[model samples]
Target: MHLISYITSRSQISEKSIQNTIELLNEDCTIPFISRYRKEKTGNLDEIEIGQIVQLKEQFEALEKRKVSVLKILEEQNVLTSDLKQKIDKTDDLTTLEDIYLPYKKKRKTKAETARKNGLEPLAKMIMSQRINDLDYTASKYTSNEVESSEKALEGARFIIAEWINERTDIRNNIRYQLERFATISTKIIKSKKEDEKAQKFKDYFDWSENLSRIPSHRLLAILRAESEDFIRVKIEIDNERALQKMEDRIIRSQNKCAEQIELAVADAYKRLLYPSLSNEALSIAKEKADEAAIGVFTKNLQQLLLGAPLGEKRILAIDPGFRSGCKIVCLNEQGDLLHNETIFPHPPQNRDTDAIKKISSLSDAYKIEAIAIGNGTASRETEQLIKRIHFKNEIEVFVVSEAGASIYSASKIARDEFPDYDVTVRGSVSIGRRLADPLAELVKIDAKSIGVGQYQHDVDQSKLKKSLDATVEHCVNKVGVNINTASASLLSYVSGIGPKLAENIVTYRNENGSFSDRKTIKKVARLGGKAFEQSAGFLRIKNGDNPLDDSAVHPEQYPLVKKIAKDVGKNISDLIGNSSELKQIDLNKYITDTVGLPTLKDIISELEKPGLDPRKKAKAFSFNQNIKSITDLHEGQLLPGIVNNITNFGCFVDVGIKESGLVHVSNLANTFVKDVNEHVALHQQVIVKVLEIDVNRKRIQLSMNYK
Candidate 1:
């Protein structure tokens, strides 16, 4: 139990607590709720901490059960000894335990085991001593019908001892670690193989090996994966003479023959036993490192995608573009207050909209929309035209907003908060309008996966993808604290400890109860434990609360110290905290303590300067040429300004004027030296591109980043 605690770095986990959490997990007690509402029992651990503990506990229990099963198997074979029992009972890591039991482990024929069966175990043990290196003298004593010649005698002896040497897990572990220290990984082009036309994809890994430690994580994973697919092969056996010398120095110096035999045996064992077993281990290490690097890029992409600045403080008439179901139109007032919503099928029924005109005129007159946000989904162009026909001129600006994740948010708790009576489809339209107004705030409600930032996203490992994206979202959400007064359950879920289910529960509780006066209300939510509240409360802000710092990220645990800080500033806690100049005067060193390090203290000071501030970059406004409304409006040799929507190996897509967007082929990227698209263009980048060709028939427009 102490070992488990030390390994996991937890003081203790009572059986009762484990059973309780397991039962709650079985009963669907959401982590935030279980962590927040059920605080007393969990020792104040937060949702993430509790989740990790659960995972560790599960693994620990499984290992314990496995130990019993292994012992039972050995007992059944009547081979369980007190010494073996002690080793098994004492061991923790599965690999090391398996190593310790290898000598007694059952297996098919091996060279050493075959020689042992051939009555040459004694001879093998003798040769391993290396005390008499004459070869003939050593072999003559063990000579028999089974040991036909000196070569046969030595070979059989070496094989038997090697197996025994490998059975010692300690020696094998030491040698493995040593080899890892000395191992190098390198890559080389298979000179003969690269000539084949079929090897284009694997040409990068033709022949590569490097210092195992220095190999870039992603490159290593790629090589290993290539090898698994039979595009290449990898190996990690130790250098023979160097390894032999090291073993001789480490083994011969020891006095005991059995011990010396074990040492020499370990070297032989490394080649025959440990080498085969660790191939998969090396491959896994490579993949894990690769996944980490890939996830970092994925994390950055997710954060930027979510943190896209919102147009904030705009009255928008959002359109969900469609053909079969027509378009869903939702209007929002200056405050994101939905004024009216209606569906219009202006395209299919006819290019004109007598009914839509009436509805739009009435909704427009009633709501007085300041701008129009059109979803860049199916039928967007037609919808844009439909909306344009009845334009009120300067009163509104039409903007095409990416409707990615709008559907996800619509069915989310945040959406439900604004439109309790509206359906999911209607809520989706509202989300699109709100997104154009305040993208970062609205996107926080939707899962990052739905934001559409990857290549072949659906084909990758979904759970792994979700975990990485979720972590990124959490980091962003915490970085930009949510306004508890206005935040929906959807956005709240991304705030560190809060998850989707818990966020919904928080909102539900708020709806059933009332708006939160302070974060303390979190304690009232069903099943919420202390840990959940501790992690989430600081990040979830209430605009005007009893403790003004509640509107900032200063946790309740640090409130008393904050009050002391206020005293030092010669003002009440509320007055001094949010005043930037006043906060600047107060020394942070005065507030420092053992519990709060400089990193955390600095963060607190920053929060005080801008309470409940949205940390995302501000949105930039752009205008398209009034003359260009559709792809047909484009003319060859005409230049236009655009933002790079996405870059791929083949070309870069620029959102010039039309919703369809135009592609700038790799050839058109620059006049010289373009190896990778990433080096030239990136997602959401602004660049000046010239129209090269427009094939109106195919709806393909060629554009170029080539000079003016």
Candidate 2:
């Protein structure tokens, strides 16, 4: 099928670039490695472009495999012809290939197959020819033991003719095209389940009708979920009269004696086969589009959450706020090791406020805690207030970190291994502190889906979702460059070519042999091969390493070039490491070689300017409105400060330091129309929202940024 040409045409990448990228992928090279290290070979293609190439190549291979299956089936049937083989070989689309093979496909016993078996095939052919004037006489000739009467024979003939019309590619494609343009998706609440409590959330979808093409991904997924739960009956349909007219126009050629029979056959096909098939096809396409959109949102949110501002290495006092069980508090050192673990009753039920205050203050003084991290769950607001009232010895910055996946991480095997002696509460508190310290390292311990930042994430395609979120993690990890000496096995696994086994080996080697002093030491780890080292070296950082460039983004292969640049300036490598002026004097053209291009050389110069620096911003302290503690405290028309916690197509959900997060609909995001909610708000962005409406009964808060 000329897969390279097809992929190039589809992806809009150069043929040469696609070929090279496909070869590299065939050699088991990861996208992160290819995009960052093989830029000169891929024409400077980024990860996204490389990912597209990989997807298209995989798709082409799947289609090719299907084509082989189809060809073998046709050959077994002894129906494969040169022209048919050529057609199948020329087309790479699965749908097109399946359409071409539809007529030849074997089916179980049906009315049409039964009709053909009853010797009514000649009558059907006569009717389809549109030349028979005596159609009744022709049908009468085909009457036999199975077909008792001429009417029965004609009925059988009509069934065969209907099958023919259904199998025609032109008619099916035309109807499919019309369906795509005119289809409407309708949902009806099941009468028995109409009053069901679980059905109330889907009230908007009940008795609703919308153009299939116009429905947003989230809305469609919501409706589909309702349908799957049997709360609603969903249907995709088009205008019957217009759809039938289009089908007849494509199938019927003349107004002759057989025209009426052909018309009947076409109508039967529309009702029995074509319409149902095309409606499902339209729905499937819509579903695929929705899946892609949902996956894209999930990927973006995961990336933002993973690359969220890091609080850096600070001795943190973390709390997983609770009520009856008391707040779980853990004091962590700069390295995120649990130094002290205890319970503090700062909230109701066990309100030992005096003792809790004393405990917190004493721990702060003892650990020399630089910051306090409180999980934004349970009695988080009250916990924050309790901590704020304490007059600690240090000017501790308290952060209300999102505890989205802390529970999942705490109960995980990874957590159990890291702290076997501690309970879930202590482990959770440690996670909260570690997340504040280094978000990427801590968050990787849990599944991305468990983190609550997506829209209909569970309802979307699971495998696709996993692939996309995994890619995002890899991208963020490689982008920020992991510290080999300090990064955990989970964090190291996302670094370019390093997977689970290699990451574990590196960690085990480190535990036995101490920290990796340079990038070159990675190769000495058991089972870490040359290719793995080559792919993973550039993204693994070694701070204060034996070699200075190893800490920078420059590949080990380019250490010589940096050395040459340093020698050219008549200075050692250390003298030119951070000296931007010295770097500026050297011509980038002088360093360009067959293997290295200006894009890479320019990157090396930029890296030297900020060696091993994290691209993420520093985590800063944010304050919620102290007066508004919960939903009960919120009032309409009151402007309050909030942080954007989750985003979707329709709007962004803001946490205004309350139990219930408020929704700022896209229409209320700005005075002008907001086409995309993301353009107006991002995850963790601080903004002021005016309370438009408050539903205390539903525990829902509607907010708006358009208010004065």
TM-score on alpha carbons, each prediction: 0.63, 0.98
**Regions of candidate 1 where Cα sits further than 4 Å from its true position:** 1-120, 130-276, 322-326, 333-365, 378-390, 393-397, 405-430, 438-447, 454-467, 496-502, 519-523, 527-534, 544-550, 554-609, 623-708
Residue 686, candidate 1: Cα error in Å is 3.7
Global lDDT scores for all candidate models: 0.70, 0.90
Clashes per candidate (backbone, < 3 Å): 29, 0
Compared with the true structure, the alpha-carbon lDDT of candidate 1 equals 0.70
**Best-fitting candidate, scored by TM-score:** 2
Give per-residue CA lDDT, model 1, range 1-708, as digits (tens): 433452345425565565566666665555544554455455455656666665566566777777888898899889999998998887766676677666667888788777887777777756555555455666667767777876686667777777765565555666666556766655555556666666656667887667775676546666655565556667664566665555556556545544445565656766667666664465456555666555555555566666766676877888898876878998898667777887887777454467887777677767777778888788776667666778573467777777878888888766786788999879998888888887767776776767765533443456777876776676667767777667766677777566778887887888788878887887888767886776677778886776687787677887887778777667887677668887777677766565565555666678788777776665565555556777888888887888776554456778875766798988999898787666787666678888888877556789999865
Best by lDDT: 2
Deviation from native of the Cα of residue 221 in model 1, angstroms: 5.7
